[model samples]
Target: MLTFEHDYTRLPEPLWLACEPSGVRAPKLIAFNEALARKLGASVVPDDETLAQWFSGNEIPSGAKPVALGYAGHQFGNFVPQLGDGRALLLGDVVDAEGKRFDVQLKGSGRTPFSRGGDGRSPLGPVLREYLVSEFMAAVGVPTTRALAAVASGERVARQMPEPGAVFTRVASSHVRVGTFQFAARHGEETTRALADYVIARHYPEAREQDDPYLALLECVTRRQAELVARWMSLGFIHGVMNTDNTSISGETIDYGPCAFMEQFDPRKVFSSIDEGGRYAFNNQPAVAQWNLARFAETLLPLMNVQGEEGVELAVEVIRGFEAHFDKTRQALRIAKLGLAEDAGDTADTLMDALETLMHQGRMDMTATFDALTHYAEGFDDIRREALLALTDQPEAFDAWLEQWRAAPLLNDATRFDAMRLANPVVIPRNHRVKEVIDSAMEDDFAPFHTLLSVVSAPFDESVEARRLAAPATDSQAVLRTFCGT
Candidate 1:
């Protein structure tokens, strides 16, 4: 028997709306993460038929208390006072065998007060995309929400056209967001303080021991966001939307709408069809994260210091730390990717910058470029170098960076191949490949989707057949824009 706990209900009543997921028809199991289910300590895994019913919100489990969380976000630089979980329901928290707590929620469950006159359901494509990408992120060691199960609703939703409706079971550290603090701040000082205390106790227990716990919480969240976004940039993952509400206070990547991995490396890449001004572009992620953190810091001011100006000054100091933290983290990542030692820091940075310049100028495939370097480290230099040189119009620039890297003392390491393999994944969820999955699923064929998921699950492992997935898309296969599918 699984016990469901309602720790979130202890918060202020206005923070959420008590509700149950609207039932779906003919719910059928699409995919299940059996490993994750066992990790969550389910003694008996239900049959697929029964599992689908529970995940689709057609059948409630024992001791479940569903609710829709409330929050406010600055959407594309404009503050929206109210935006919350319109179609998602927090079923309850489940404690794993390892004693870690995770919120188990059903997205596309149904309508709630927070729906804001919109349909509270998710399209099939987005549901599968989130499941695939989130699990892929986890496999690659990125902190992100995990997909537990996906269920077909036997219903269709109208987006750009008629699309199948589906429900996704998501497991997360917590659903709390920077916008949650923003919501508390709107209610006044006491509410914000209470929220700070609660978040500190739940996520940052060390903060409670600090002389100024709220400030510590601010700094902790700041550093985590810095590290998280830096990793995203290193992996060429472009989060199309970085709104305050979508920015998880827990620092795990959440809300994978319109998100994509770049085929050709470009700092100004924008995949979200809705982002007209390129506010959340590939290179702008770190800056946008810092921008969101500033909003978060604004909510912490009342609790940081009694004097208003002093609090603002303190918050500004913490916000400034984001740049230093991001630069250090991103640089360390680049060093590792290039198989460099501590002494090669400057050289690694220069090599990375030069490579990025060459890639951008030559329109090189991001994942392939990194993957080829791993082969080069494994002593396949001649073939890999020739292949890489063929892709670049700026052969001189590429040759220059290669020469600098070749001379670095770090190249003497005997385990360079192992190190580079760990740093560079063999495969990512390519846009063309993911589109292939969605197109097949739309035709009620899920073989392509399952195969793609399996390939991405072990990103670092090298397989002959899987190497085909690493290939860059052709001009006809390129996907320029991705939709929210709301």
Candidate 2:
């Protein structure tokens, strides 16, 4: 049996609305994360039907108190003053063996008061996508929400076409988002302070020791987000929708809607069908994160000890520090990817810039290029060297850069190869592969989905099977745009 705590419910009433999950017709368990369940201290192994019943919201787990969280967001630069958990319910909190609290949520469980005229259901494709991609992100060492289970509703949801429905059970540190504070700020100063206090007590207890806890909390969140965005960039991951509500206070990547990994090296790449202006493009993530943090900062101004323009100046100072935090993390990542020592310094920066320029000009496959470099670093063989060169249209320029990289202050050959291997994944959940899995699952074929999941779970394995999934999509197989599945 799973036990849960109700700390969030203890918060002010405005933050969440008590509700029950709208049960589905027929629930069939499609996936269960046994390893994560064990980590969360769930010892009882229930049968598939029972697991489906609980996860699909047909039978709410004992000790669970479901609620729809309230928050407003700036969606694509437009402020939506009232948007909340339209199709999801927080199924209380769980404390792991290590005593860390995590929010257990059932997404696509059905509608709540915040449904706003839309059906509170999710199509199976998105449930599968989030399960695969979010788990892949966790495996790759990215801080992200985890999928504990997925259950098919055995029914259909209305989209452009009638699509099979599913519910996803997600675990995260907490669901508090920047937009939560925005909603709180609208209620009054005391409500915003209460929300901030709850967040600090739950996520940043260390801030309590600081001279100004609110200011310290803002800095902590800003720094975490900066580093998180930097990590995303290093992996060529684009989080297609970067709304304020999707930005977590705990700094984990949340809401895996319309998200994709970059196949080709393009700074301006945008895969979200709704992102016509390329607002949340691949390279624009860092800036968008800073902008979101600025919004978060606005909500905390009234609570800051310093009043008037002084508090604004202080907040602005912390917000501007995002650039430094991001650059430090990004530089360290680049150095590791290049297999260079920390002391290599400016040489690594110059070399990285030149290589990225070549990649952009050639439209090189980002993951493949890094994998090729990892192989070449193992030993300077003709075949491996040629493989790296093949990814570039300007082979001669790449060849020159390769010599510079080889001669730079790198670690010993063994250590350098090991570093590159760890930094560059052998496989990612490629856009085409994910799309294929979704299409196959829609036809009741799950073999491809399982195969892709297993391959991505061990992203650094250089096995023949992993290499088989490493290739980028061909022109015919490329997925140009992705939908939110709303």
**Per-model RMSD to reference:** 1.2, 0.8
TM-score for each model: 0.98, 0.99
Each model's total of backbone clashes:
0, 0
lDDT string, candidate 1, 1-486, tens digits: 357898888888578889878998879899999899888877788899989989999988888899999999999999998888999999999888878788999999989889998789999999999999999999988899999999989999888789999999999999999999898889888888877887887789998888888899999999999999999999999999999999999899999999999878899999999999999999999999999999999898778754588778888899999999998988888988988886677888888998898899988888888888878777756888887687778878887778877888675558887887787899999988899999999888988989889999988878875798878899999999998777
For lDDT, the strongest prediction is 2
lDDT of 2 by residue, 1-486 (tens): 678998898888778999899999999888999999989889997999999999999998999999999999999989898899999999999899999999999999999988998889999999999999999999988999999999999999999999999999999999999999998899999999999999999999999899889999999999999999999999999999999999999999999999999988998999999999999999899999999999999999999899899999999999999999998888888999999988876887888888888899988899999889988988889999999999988899889989999999988876988899888999999999999999998998888988888899899987888888888999999999999899
Candidate 2: C-alpha RMSD to true structure equals 0.8
Candidate 1, superposed: residue stretches over 4 Å from native: 411-413
> Residue 364: error of model 1 in Å?
0.9
What shift in Å separates residue 183 of candidate 1 from its native position after superposition?
A: 1.1
Superposition error at 42 for model 1 (Å): 1.1
Give the per-residue Cα lDDT of candidate 1 at 247: 99
Looking at model 1, report the run of 10 residues with the lowest lDDT sum. 404-413
Give candidate 2 regions above 4 Å deviation: none
lDDT of 1: 0.89
